[model samples]
Target: MKSRSLQPQLANLPNYKVRESHKAKHVNLKISPHHGLEVVVPKGFDHRRIPEILQKKQKWIDKIARQFEAQQEFLTPTAADQGVTEIVLQAIAETWRVEYVPTSNPHVVVTEKPGQQLQVRGAITHTDLCHKALCKWLAHKARTHLVPWLRTVSHEVQLPFEQASVRGQKTRWASCSQNKMISLNYKLLFLPPEVVCYVFVHELCHTIHMNHSAAFWQLVGEKDPNYEQLDAELHNIWRYVPVWVEH
Candidate 1:
């Protein structure tokens, strides 16, 4: 669908493409890094009304869209850019200068150098292999930094979970099960420390309230007073994630 399909009331809004899904029960609007201004609606909903719904949420949409552009600049560098040269991990408060060298060998090799530098050699010309090697190192960083960090936060917040697992989740930042198990996204390394703490507090509350009811949000507020603001930030947290990691 085209922006022309929208009602005249939304003429001022940016053009948005539409997609209809039978599985969808409500209208959903969000900006994708690769696809801008996408609107998904139930198969039979009045398409004209989408503009009104979007108009009402224009402020949020614009805010999130702006974030996508300003997210980790290295994630989508400019035309002159070659590859990921350096990475700064705010959650861990560490920055690594990177160097890549192509080799005739088939396997990629990585080494952590002095002065906060990293050397990647072998198959450097192969983007897929290079990304794989980088992600493997990132997982190691998550285990070294995120796991212990979560435990420390859980202790400080007085919410001891049974277990914690980190992963490359594309859609979710974290989740807690009734069994007291918690799973977190490794991409969280890209977010600010305070934002990361908010995700933990959110999931830890799930140990008490699985449903997102008013009571659940109240519990989150008690733990993190800025839960509302943190929740809003999560809407476009993917901006922090590097495109090379493949989520």
Candidate 2:
């Protein structure tokens, strides 16, 4: 077993990835419905034994992978799947109307208008193009909405950072650098307000303490008492993201 401390370590396997969490008190293997196999361990865990452990759990991993594959097959939509004409920005509590217009050239142009309407001009026949336009618009919405929200939270909590940015990350909701710069996943716009606030406070605490030490979590708890619940809720929020904008 590794020494108990802070900071998680990532180990990529042949088929999946393992994230060793410092807070983990035991050797635990999790098979995510979205991600594949993840191995969590207490800090100071034996790094060389991961392969052996995975080999021991191969059958379980295979079973879980099959289950996830079946679920994804059902959840994944076709390109022509019901065009997403309306969406709700849960983080900001705003309902948006999405309008799609077809164009001749293979290009997508998105314009944000008044009255919570987004105009997507592109090759509607090309669902890929339409999806692209919608994705671009989502990013724009995050930049316009999330970045400013972070600034406001920083001010409210009196925890200032150098700057903030939004990106389309596949595996992370948000991150903070040693230089005090924070990067937020644009998909956070899909999460509820409380969960979004928890994420912001989590990263903001990172600016002061880079690791999830006792002191760090103490600060987070002080800010948001329900952070534990909110953090747990984040694990399943991907299902709420509009399918077209997820890519």
TM-score of each: 0.75, 0.75
lDDT, model 1, position 31:
66
**Clash totals for all candidate models:** 0, 4
Q: How do the residues 138-219 of candidate 2 rate in per-residue lDDT, one tens digit apiece?
A: 7888999999999989988889999888888766789999899999888888888878988999999988988777899899
| Number of the top TM-score candidate | 2
* Candidate 2 Cα misplacement greater than 4 A, ranges: 1-15, 19-34, 38-48, 51-74, 79-81
lDDT for 66 (candidate 1): 72
Model 1 segments beyond 4 Å from truth? 1-55, 66-81
What Cα-based lDDT does every candidate model obtain? 0.77, 0.74
- Please give the TM-score that candidate 2 achieves against the real structure: 0.75
Best by lDDT: 1
Model 1, residue 35: C-alpha shift (Å): 6.7
| Residue 5 accuracy (lDDT) in model 1 | 47
Tell me how far the alpha carbon of residue 53 in candidate 1 is from the true structure, in angstroms, after superposition.
Answer: 4.1
